[model samples]
Target: MTALSELNDDVVRSMSIGAVFSDFDGKINCLDFHRTADLLVTSSDDDSVRFYDIATARLVKTTYHKKHGADRICFTHHPSSIICSSKHNPDSNGEFLRYLSMYDNRCLRYFKGHKERVVSLCMSPVNDGFMSGSLDHTVRMWDLRVNACQGIMHLQGRPTVAYDQQGLVFAASMEGGVIKLFDSRSYDKGPFDTFLVGGDTAEICDIKFSNDGKSMLLTTTNNTVYLLDAYHGEKKCGFSMDTSPTATIEATFTPDGQYVLSGSGDGNLHAWNISDEPNKVGSWDSYIGVVSCLRWAPRRVMFAAAAASVLTFWIPNDAKSEPGAPNPEG
Candidate 1:
């Protein structure tokens, strides 16, 4: 059955390439391109971050955004605002607040109380609340609504978080090799419950909620992907790719939940079809350096991935193929 499907399906019919863009003197450590505004933000290992107009593919500005180095960045749902973060270091007392920026890093807001490097940051998919996870083994909620620390939810191990469409939280941790789920409303008390994935496979690297909040996708250092029930974090399905694993650093689910996309230390971008049972329909490869980040842009019909100093846009094969096959970034 697997062999027959492989012959019949155009999982990766072809790849549509966009204008490749790059900047900065060092590796592009993190990237987030805005969908509506057509703005692209990239942070580098050189303690600098740059903004670019994607439609025009022109540099807008450069700012001393990070003191040591930037690890991740994202544009807030707010039109002109962006949020940036770094690993918490004890030597830096006000590092967390220094990381948040507005208007080319001129104005800053501090998020206090996290004692270690911040590992993950995300905006709530439903509400105005934004979240940050730290190596300190805690995930915190910040209400931009009130501009205050709303609550702190402790985790068993350092974890990365993703907010579902309904605003529920899903945290992926290496300690238990599982994803934990929590209601943003009940976060003040503690984690409401957790869904555990067993066996000593490898450290969990990234996690994201499906568009509808009904499913989730997780990646690991072992070059593997797992899909789960988003509400409870239950492992519903999983698949492995042929690409050699680097530090399989990030994974994202397509908006429709039919595909899993990831970037790795091996400098490659991979797409896997999870629309079927017991087997992944197909996979694809691109990019020349370690792909450290991946983000979906539905309005543009493409997804973006960042390597050391480059950004590449990937679109599904423009030609229509069979059903139940990987179409595009979806």
Candidate 2:
């Protein structure tokens, strides 16, 4: 699976279910793969955070938060540490994010400020610095070493944030289809440039930057996913997704950035070949429930999709080891 040749449209088109997990008792809210590890972490409405060894296809650990509940999660460099956003009622208890060491079940710190629950969280590509976007109309930056939020941006609407592959810059998508790019080191100076998302009027649900930093992805509440030229702010293509309001759909770029994939309300996994015109390359419809969360493995030839409580892992069928596969032998 490490071989670069495995990364291709033909291979992705041939991809199918390789593994499935049914351990979750509630809806899975989000999942993330470790940058250089064989691990995948997920946060759910069940108030639990679970870790799966993607290379081994097994659940390694599960921890619960009975007090606050867990929704969004991201690894903080160390495999044992993570940052989790609370799933508690946003109105009653102003939302605060918790940084914890799962190995010992110890709380390390709590990041407080936002008046509403955080909806998006991303770990910086290069360091302990990270970003969180909330329903409170603000995006805040924090460093793992400190307890205070390092920076905050008062946006006009709900926001989503992402860092480029190099982590030298980050992008924020807010109300009115506005996309703002900032220099990571001196973000307070403000965005260097602002781009709009193909004139769409929907609120952006999430934003992602391609590994090469050449493409930007915008997933809006209106079920439209757009791929834009990161530098020039030109729309390269737009795909109308079939997602449900009950689930927050997330679209991802392949590691090579040549394709985009997402799960839909119809329980189908959809992919588009974006090297050019962005045509639908495939739509596998085997899933039984509304596929809500989806993510592409950072380095492996795999992608995972989740429904209410089941998570399905997919891999190219042509590979030596297919279903529930380990890294294929070259």
Candidate 3:
């Protein structure tokens, strides 16, 4: 594993926009990169789901859901499959979580239960089972092979959920800056531990566990991002941005967990060096719109950011010159 102290601000500042995909008609909701490949999956408010070849920086597949547009999307354990929580139709009693076969754009399974929009969805790192948190004040677990929900937990307010890298623990952020951690093996009995961020009244927009499982990142609607110790949930530091009043901006850590990246309503991408004093190290003007979604590649130094209708791929300028470095350009 790469040490966080070894990363410098220059390398992060060297990141430049390498490619851009601008075909979506609405704002990009989320971006997910394959754990072992250069493939990328994205969901948009335009009612479309897209697959892209990151190396070639081209669209590989495109599918649409006209009725209820896709929101939170993630790639399953299978390379050719994905799951997304979408809006509920008129006749439906609740929202539907669709597991789609990417090869044919067919719905393989539908998990339903949330009475409102499902705002958070995260796939388990080691299993086919995944979990979701919704505006309906519920968190439900599902398996990709089955249509029935496995378990459900009700909360007081909106929730943002995430799984640790080891898949042994999952965390759900609820109202009042509280985070509930559950053991994946026995979640039905209730959370084994809970952590609260003091003095924060913002609604958490998203939560992410570092790849090393040592740290966690939380993005809130109040334009702030909080870093915490994954095990004890002690607040390490926090970063803030100028976010739009209605936008749910996201943030993520680099693959090595050295730095934090976030999008801003000011059309800039922000980065902070986590190993040093908590401070802004780099900022790139995307110049697209309010950056709505941000994600880092699972095994590379690259990352992707999306705004209103554009997706941009970023890479370090010296990546090509470094010996044995993976080429960003195909």
Model 2, position 304, has a per-residue lDDT of 80
Candidate 1 lDDT, 187-287, residue by residue in tens: 55555677777774565667777766677777766766778776666687765643453434567766566666666555556666666653444445554
TM-score of candidate 2 relative to the true fold: 0.94
| Positional deviation of residue 154's Cα in model 3 after best superposition, in angstroms | 0.5
Which tens-of-lDDT digit does each residue in 1-330 have in candidate 3? 122344568878888776778878988888898887778999988889999887666788999998878888999987779998885472365756888899988988778777788889999999888999888898999888887889999898889899999999999989999999999999988899999988989888799999899999998888788999998999999877896966767898987787899888777888898875677898888767777788988866677888878888877776556554433442
**Candidates 1 and 3: which is better by TM-score?**
3
Best by TM-score: 2
Q: Candidate 3 at residue 279, lDDT?
A: 77
lDDT of 2 at 29: 87
lDDT of 2 by residue, 59-170 (tens): 8899999888998899988988899998885444454788999899989988878888898899998988999999888999999889888999999888989999999999
Q: How far off is residue 310 in model 1, in Å? A: 1.9
Quote the lDDT for 232 in model 2.
89
Clashing pairs in 2: 18-324
